[model samples]
Target chain A: MRVSKFDRPYESGRPERHQLRVENISLSFGGVRALTDVSLTCEPGEILAIIGPNGAGKTSMLNCICGLYHPQKGRIMYGNHNLARTSSHHLPKMGIARTFQNIELFRHMTVLNNLMLGRHVHMKKNILTALLYWGWAEREEIENRRFVEHVIDLLEIQHIRKQMVGSLAYGLQKRVELGRALAMNPGLILLDEPMAGMNVEEKEDMARFILDINEEWGITTILIEHDMGVVMDISDRVAVLEFGRLIGIGTPDEVRENPDVIRAYLGQDHGGRS
Target chain B: MMATTQCGVFHESYRSDMQLRPTTWQRLRVVVVFAFIIILPFVASAQNLRIANTVVIAAIGAIGLNILVGYTGQISLGQGAFLAVGAYSTGLLMHYYELPWPIALVLGALITAMFGAVFGIPSLRLKGLYLAVATLAAQQIVGWFVRNWDPIDGTKADGAARELSMPRALFFGDKLNDSEFAFYVVGMIALVIVAVVATNLFRTHIGRAFVAIRDQDIAAEVMGVNVFQYKLVAFATSSFFVGLAGGLTAVHSTNISFERFTIDVSIEYLAMIIIGGLGSISGSIYGAAFVKLLPEILRDVGLWIADQGWLASGQLDQYLPFAEDAAFGLAIILTLIFEPEGIVKLWSDLKAYFRLWPFSY
Candidate 1:
């Protein structure tokens, strides 16, 4: 809420972090319901995982919270603001950032540029200064780039920092996407299936990165992952959805023992993917 | 802190690491090219200077157009129309209002920026070919207004294009009387400023927002890039350059006419960016040079053929214009068919191939 200087450490660095509260939000496309009366609170600075089968409206739920999809029914609140009224473009300015289900990086740009782009909301705008690359623009650029370097370091993407995002491997692209979201320095991060296509080693790396993001920066993470093993390993809490409804929401062990969650998700597939 | 560089080179600070031209070799190349540019006027004839001015002006305009269609992925068929706005605005300001040429030129460009933003409004709802068609409306409307409005030297007949002249620019009370050479230097300066500004823009977050929107709009929006705002900014920025080009055309040619900037000119601008390279800044200049030079080269070749007795002079004259037009069409087709990425990519590939000479395949 304090909007003065652009060069604050990160949104997560701010002391007054607020939790995301989604209240009875219902979303549907024609007759097919994407999310039906789904309501859950994302606690500040915790890695919360939402796991379900395909078309279970996990991304839709994220989208509604992201302002990409406005729920037809109830209010989704991020701190003091009602997200229904907040435009999607202003989400990052409000300290909210999300990565996509598929890698949605600026393909032609190098990894550095993509990460710097995540700093878009924070960058001061002065065309004359930017064009001349002097004073405010030059000083601002080096400062933000210093932050992006930290992200590249955190994600261990030092080697591919200058490589074009398109030329990078799928796992690397996903990590870069996460790096981009991290570059925003958001208090809350929505990651849609960050480990969908990764191999086991890649998955483990992504899991560690996700945990580091949550623990070190205290970035509240709402991760949608299908790999239950990875999900249970990293998530502080688990929310299970089936056919557009939340079957259960609790700690990983509590969700694993829930009767409905067992029948719907864990029973069909033991510790691996269903 | 230590930083990585080409084996021997090292960057010890962020400012050093983030330099536009970090290496000695790169700095030397820039200085050498600038030195050559400074000496060019002394050696080149007036005719060559005139032609080079045209190419430089085209490059400026192409850079603008490329920012919209090529970099930002917003197709505009109103480039020529925007050019007319610049030309006529500068022409009217200099002639009737008697404003200083520099002030008039800047005002003219700014005026065209407003016009571009007005036309770009529809882009929020339209895209691709649909957007192209929408922009074409600007070409028609501007063309119609110039042909009908009396202040702009309107003519009753359809093909009768009236010329509106602009006064010569006075620099420190000097008339800039070196003529073609003066215009060439001015054109080169403008080209350098525009190119450098664009290059600087792409390195920052503003430029990243434009590319992000182009690559993926939804992601850009969610990532906090105001998509519609940036699209309008692209339109206005591109028009500022294009309008500057048009204003220069008025001052350089000393005459502005509707006939000179028709839809054909708009298409030519599009071809320049397309043949140069999409989403590449330097590609705009390359494309502009190729397109503007194609006709001149064709004419010279045609004249040579006639002089060599391969074709009669009278017969060559009859088909020369047709040949030039056909060559333009053919060049675009050939470029698209072979190197769809355009001349920029082709030039880069050639450099890469030759980097490891003789022994390499």
Candidate 2:
């Protein structure tokens, strides 16, 4: 659960391994600015954490990356794709999967069904084949179920496989949401407040799962978490936003010691958690 | 209650696990229902057989509506309009082109499916009651077109009626003997096929996506489900079944009119799904039976009351229709109040109560 900078072969080659780049992005709603000239890069197979106080456009930045919002100006380059032109429906298919801040598991569906839905892009059966539910459809289903089952196992949600997601506790629902994103088998995973509203035990479990997803699966992750302790321990890079501006971006240790970052946290009396 | 929940029920393989009816009791129940339906024509009178026919037709329409309004969670008040599209297309193909019944049926379904998809385009941007109102406009537009078009020659002078009859619903190169026989054979077969497809649909990837969209469109979109495409598919799939049912109705009744596919008819469909159980395939049949038969039962009650000298025949006639409509309205209200989940839940509850009798736990 500790952030080991040298355990991985990424630090020296970080710039060369850049997988996502957000440059000169400005977004607004009506007359209020949400994000302005915000820029950051996520290297391959590393956890990049975004920390900000409330109303600092942290969620809006994630929304911009996943094509939920049109930023009015700037470019979001993910590999060769421009995220500004990508729609939400196309995000997962293009290897970008995200979990919402609030749990968004399909409430009436079983956890298995919700996870299976995460494999929507992977399953290629047409309507005719789906109607038969045999041969090609059955084959595709079993193949995808193997992946979903792996996610279920990884997230330790086997006990609630058949249970409706709506009836679950909030922490379990959040885990199911992460399992859903994992089931997508994406190259880049965007998790918004993955450990929000969890007890210490649940938060520790989530932190471990996030690390496992990033290290073991080689999946690039952009995480937004309020627990500075967990963020400092897990993240390879940290970006700080305040009042719609990127005030600092660096390694967690470097960002933590910056005077501007210190002043920003103290200005809000945010307990130096940032 | 724990007896059934115990871990004795076993599936030996993946194929068995995916079975629609995994338990012997469920299989037996399905067999018994089909057997009873197959044997009903011999024991029942022709009039009663026609009622069965109507239920079968309505059940197909109800199942279609359920796919849109139930599984997909899209509110549609335009199901009847889609039915009209099927009926008219099939009627025209039969009347002018002289196509076979099967071709006409398939083509009619496809045409109505296209119309349904077109009407569904607005659904991505609109939802809930607003979407319902937009679909209501579809109903109005279709109704107006059918009433005023007069494309074929069988229009009555009043313009309200059209002699939209099937020459004879030919089954395996043999003509159906009568309307009762048609319902017994053609309608029953259609119901079985549609029920099977509709039941299997919810088990597949596409069906799950539809349910996901219904539960939460934003989450479905984020999960790689093309919400817009799936919603359109749901509308088209629903209208296909309704249109096919409409084709069956056109052939069985040998007459068609704009009044048949009115807003009231669409609301009746909504009631059927709600009263039957929103997301259950078999519930659609229960709902269709309840809705289609209630008016007949009420009319009989009204007639018996008049015969008992409680009222003059003229006065009874004046109020009888109102009584039937009022009874329908009351049935929906009562169903919503007592069992919002519908008759399927009620049936299950009753079964559970009986199974756990004497203990009261």
Candidate 3:
């Protein structure tokens, strides 16, 4: 039988296509291999979902893409630039932004400040200017604040703009985290379990926001999610991982019908759905 | 959550413009504080002035410690050692090279910052208790070398006898060997350092990164902050301020000794930050004043009680010696248990309560 559109076979991008590419990536923590020879590529403006069992190294792959982890073996290429060798600090500048599996909002700061921190990569003011709050610093601050406000509106978190992130509800906090990542205005965005513990309503809201972010923002999105329903609904393509190896790669319908992918989910009642 | 409700209307008003202090009352408070500081020298007694100067200098050190320990969450027992570097460098430069006091002070701070950067190398690899131990070891090694090395002190040895001398002050052609002069000098320097640190800390990326790292290192790293570089910067910045305080203390006093900058001094700084409220610039000043003056007050009270004929002089001496130490220990324990947020927090809370009174439910 022909593979479903959801499980469409991997097609190499055109020669001039600017996209993020991972080649033969492998990462081992101590003796445990978190990822082994895992390769995936995400094109601009495409929502690629990496769905896997609990220990299938979904988050690990995201980490490698953002330069959080230097794979023992692999090359992460972003828009023709080799990122594996670049400093992690330079990732945001290189148009890559990420949110954590566990919401990583700056708890003590206001939601607005947390988002503004994302703009730190692009801020051009020096220490002297920042200290004096003069000249270019004031202009820079105003510009960044406007950009952060735009992100807050985009994430639909204007009500919680001045609220401390720690004080916000879980769903709002997640949204604020998304706002923070969006403030970076990256060409590629990574979302790790964005809807991890949310109820159905919250999950729906998050899924809509994620879809809007990818579509309206015109940004490439790589999502690691356990909610197969949300993944199937929003993802243009899906990559299924089982024990550090990609079991299947295609569109959602194709992935849903893959025998290996079904067996990986059925082998153990992972029960990750909320 | 319960305590949050008790916050007063003034706090609520201030909280509305938390980042922007646009209120007239808030601006008035700043003016009042500056006025009090300006008038303090004239109104305080000689002994009080001396004590206030010590508090100011100690506050500078505590501010540095707050940046490292309180904000960055790096426990450093070696801050006193950095202070020693500054103090000794300033003392040596002023005494032997006849450098001006201002030049000596600047040079002292620069050298100390450099030394702090050097010592910060080990922190790139270690954290928590292990990092604390490393800094403690640094303290011991730096302290020992400074104490033993005569050349560093600008002193020549004469058959095992160590003759230490006080640095001379040359400001406005009038020598500043008196307590009042030292008090003014230290106070001005302390004020300048506090203002610079308070304003610069939160406004800069490095400062924000330090706080982020303190909360969660892995999360911060993932956000593209150079965790190692920021951490090292915190150590270096904290140490520079600490060293400047040490140099000021050395010049402020008539005599110099190794015992003054011992591990005990470092612990004292830690205590100040703890009691003052961790992660607060103003708290450092409050903590420093309380720690420095509390003993002096106790000593005076003990002396007064001894003169009352209710207690024998010999008995008083035996009991009084331990009394101050015991009182200080109890204060720390009680503060930790009851007011973990420290005196500055309590003060702010009270002020907030007053501001929001009647409507504060």
Interface RMSD of each: 5.6, 4.9, 8.5
lDDT tens digits by residue: candidate 2, B242-353: 9998887777655677678888899999999999999988899999999999987877887889889998869877997888788888888989999988998888787667
Candidate No. with top lDDT: 1
Q: Can you rank all candidates by DockQ, best first?
A: 1, 2, 3
Which residues of candidate 3, in runs, are more than 4 Å off? Answer: A1-17, A134-138, A267-274, B1-20, B152-163
For model 3, how does the per-residue alpha-carbon lDDT over A23-116 read when each residue is reduced to its tens digit?
8988999999999998888888899999998889998888888777888998988876787777667787677889998887778767776877
Q: Number of backbone collisions per candidate, in order?
A: 0, 0, 12
Query: RMSD in Å for candidate 2, one decimal?
Result: 4.9
Residue range with the least summed lDDT across 10 consecutive positions in model 1 chain B: B1-10
* lDDT of model 2, residue B227: 91
Docking verdict class for candidate 2: acceptable
- Model 2, span A37-112: residue lDDT tens: 8888888888999998898899999999998897888999987788976888888867788999988788988888
**Candidate 2 off by > 4 Å:** A1-18, A268-274, B1-6, B158-165, B172-177, B303-316, B351-361
lDDT of 1 by residue, B90-179 (tens): 889998999988788899999999999999999999989999999999999999888777776543465576777557776655454348
lDDT of 3 by residue, B160-217 (tens): 4243476667556545557575457655656665656455656555566777888767
Specify the poorest-scoring 10-residue window by lDDT in model 3 chain A. A7-16
What lDDT is reached at residue A178 by model 2?
A: 93
Arrange candidates by lDDT, highest first: which order?
A: 1, 2, 3
Best TM-score among the predictions, by candidate number? 1
Q: Candidate 3 lDDT (Cα, whole model)?
A: 0.77
Q: After superposition, how far is residue B216 of candidate 2 from its true place, in Å?
A: 1.3
